[model samples]
Target: MGNGISNVKPSTERSEGGEHSNSSHPHKLDQFRYKVLKAATGKFCSKNLAGQGGCSDVYKGWLGYRTATPGCGLPVAVKRIKKQGYQGLDEWNNELRILSSFHHPNVVKLLGYCAEGVHRMLVFEFMCNGSLEENLSRECCREVEWSKRMEIAKGLARGLEYLHNMDPPVIHRDIKSANILLDHDFTPKIADFGLSRFGPQGDKTHLSTRVLGTEGYFAPEYIGTGHLTLKTDVYSLGVVLLEILSGLKAVKRYPNGRRIELSQWATPYLNDKNQLHRVIDKRIIKNVDMEEAYDFATIISQCLTQDPRRRPTITQVLHSLQHIESKHQHFA
Candidate 1:
């Protein structure tokens, strides 16, 4: 698609290598992102954009100035980082590197990137249906039918499986509902790799690093020890699965002073069929099958296992979801 950039000005000067010169200061790096945003939003107006993220605004654009096939235009999404935030050129570079390495149907495809002067931006295929967060959080939107939800979960698991089983293994340091986008058909595609990292090989149990993830989604072990592993991503995926099932925010601090994290709140109902009904989103209650609901709850339990080792591999998660989907084919 055609490239776009925002109007934000670079907060600081850029280095010869295209990265910000000030390595210690994060604010200065915001300049590069600002420039990139400006470039991405330059051609496409805000009206053409569909969404915005913590550090970027997403715009829908075209693949070429002129399409070879009429009405078959290639659609794309442009992500321009916010120049006023802590995100820097390094984060942009990391995303570019990781997305460039893999190509999977379940993973969002990185079309291209621009890292010139004080500008940094990433381009990807635009997901027409938007994020899972938008769909689940809305009260009047079309219900995420149980069969579709399972299909979405299976697609996400396959994407994560690719990341986890990669040579050296890529850990998606940030995995949440907002990062899981949906296609026109409502299939899930994993997005956002700015906080991701590649793990060590050859018997290394984990990669030690500073914890970086949404508050409630960080793995318990990673929070305690700062040890990054494939399991850490698995834990985050569990939180996402919980969100998909219960239609609750991962880190919702209720007014009752009871701070209910997804993992903590879902644990009690994980295996109890009677209690499982309480955790499901009320919107789809009448449409959901009881047996499939219990199976879905069990899958969430496996993913949210306290012991990282006990968590099912993404491959296993995919298989389980596929089984559930197969059982409910007629319902769709």
Candidate 2:
């Protein structure tokens, strides 16, 4: 885990309305007919399952939102809440409450949901390219070129920036590679906001809750104290950025039987340009800009700084990425 940072202040993002407010952004929270979603997912067939997480199972589906007349259904990703306890209910409500009105090009859009009886399902635009994690797989890497990697990272940063700048900032408690989906054009969209929590309000600096997040990616402060702020999510994003550069999972066990955390294993090289070759994905080393790769490492190093107070905000991260993408020779 990264070292802890204390006394980090809440972001001063302009609060236009309270967290979960939908006054200005009045996108109707569409309620789906259980039958419709069930049909879309081929009755939740195993073959259609796209992926599974701690709280939900995502299945590929086709859905049409036409009310008056029938039309061609759009391909969709259906997230079905797994049965647990009240925790499941809370997560379902959280995704519905947050994604119902949250709209951004880089953020996944919630088409509708199924709240009938005990069934809890969320419908979203289908991402053709699976996830950033899948793309990093040896087989998939053949398709995710250097330029596409930078584009995905930049899109993820912009999504975070939008959430951070929102009135009553939204902290996407989970920001790992698996949670980032890619569309047909390889456009990135941040997903799985089930763990997301609002940023601290008024004078409060952080939200205190039970520690919950992917191992290796959770900030040390959060794991130790349950105190979460925008920085907590930023730290996770830093982990994802590092994963993108190195093509490794956040946690790994090398063949030598040495188990290591990605953040700890990659930190040293991220800070030193001279050791850049030691950390970059070998597949892309010959295909990407070395200096730009170093710059990205520097940015991730800043983000992974143990002290949350010293980490650059999402806006700054986005701008730096934009600059890199513009100048990097990814003619790949």
Candidate 3:
């Protein structure tokens, strides 16, 4: 488990229809001129800044439909690399390569890229609603109600299911809420493929790789042993679902100067149906259906199991969520 990954396989599946998915049979990726991207982002102005990562800064920009020129088509996010080191360049290339192969609705679309001189950037569809983590924060938690949370959860499951079912399969090493983007319609899209890796195939059970991901979202086994599997994503998904239900961050600092993981803090409420209310987000508490919430909690409990082998597959999780959604619709 030391980043000595090898024998990885790539996906050959093609998307039938999508905005950026309509490229070509061999996955034609757009190559954006640095000047064009700069113009689209108003010269990478601070006002257009959307996010900042350790190795890159993201700016919101608008480009032409066919030409991808400045301010004539659709809004997009431009992630510009700030570090030229090996690690930074590696992540950037990895994201570009991996995103070029994906065309799922629940996964973020890589519109194009810019690799000019010392500058390296990746362009993506700008998620209007922002990341799930941003929406769940204290300032905006109320905006995402009970139904929307369920929808987001299901969308995330679908995205993970698609990745897991790919030809060689993809393991999104980083699956935290911050990496889950939301569209104008609140459709959740899995983002940040910089740390993704191809999962084990055929006779292999798991891939031994370096452990890299958000601290709280790391699966127990992954953190301890660095064995990567599809179930690892499921465990991270459960942490995210817990955050959605409780309006809590994966890790938080308690008043006593100690930090606690959300799963450990919410275990009591998740384990006992009668105590579920104690952990429900106060902002959406009034609108939540206790029974439905309990069912959702049950699924989360199964996902958070320490034993990766015991966790339910993404498909199973999606089915359970769909069942809950159908029940809600019937009663409505």
Q: Best-fitting candidate, measured by lDDT?
A: 3
Best by TM-score: 3
Instruction: State model 1's lDDT.
Output: 0.75
For model 3, the local distance difference test gives 0.85
Clashes (candidate 3):
0
Give Cα distance to truth, residue 291, candidate 3, Å.
Answer: 0.3
Each candidate: RMSD to true structure? Answer: 9.2, 7.4, 4.6
Task: Give every collision pair in model 3.
Answer: none
* Candidate scoring better on lDDT of 1 and 3: 3
Q: Could you give the candidate ranking by lDDT, starting with the highest?
A: 3, 2, 1
Any runs in candidate 2 off by more than 4 Å, and if so which?
A: 1-26, 65-72, 139-141, 254-258, 326-332
Model 1: lDDT of residue 7: 33
Regarding TM-score, does 1 or 3 come out ahead? 3
lDDT (Cα, 0-100) at 175 in candidate 3: 95
Please give, for residues 1-332, the per-residue lDDT of candidate 1 as tens digits. 12343333322332232121212111222222333334344454766667766777777755543522222456767776666645655566677766766567778877666666545677788888889988888553677877688778888998888777766678899989989999999889999888999877898899999888888998899999999888888888988888888888898786888786878877898799888888898888888888888988898888888889998887788888888877777666
Better of 1 and 2 by lDDT: 2
Candidate with the larger TM-score of 1 and 2 = 2
What TM-score quantifies how close candidate 3 is to the native fold? 0.89
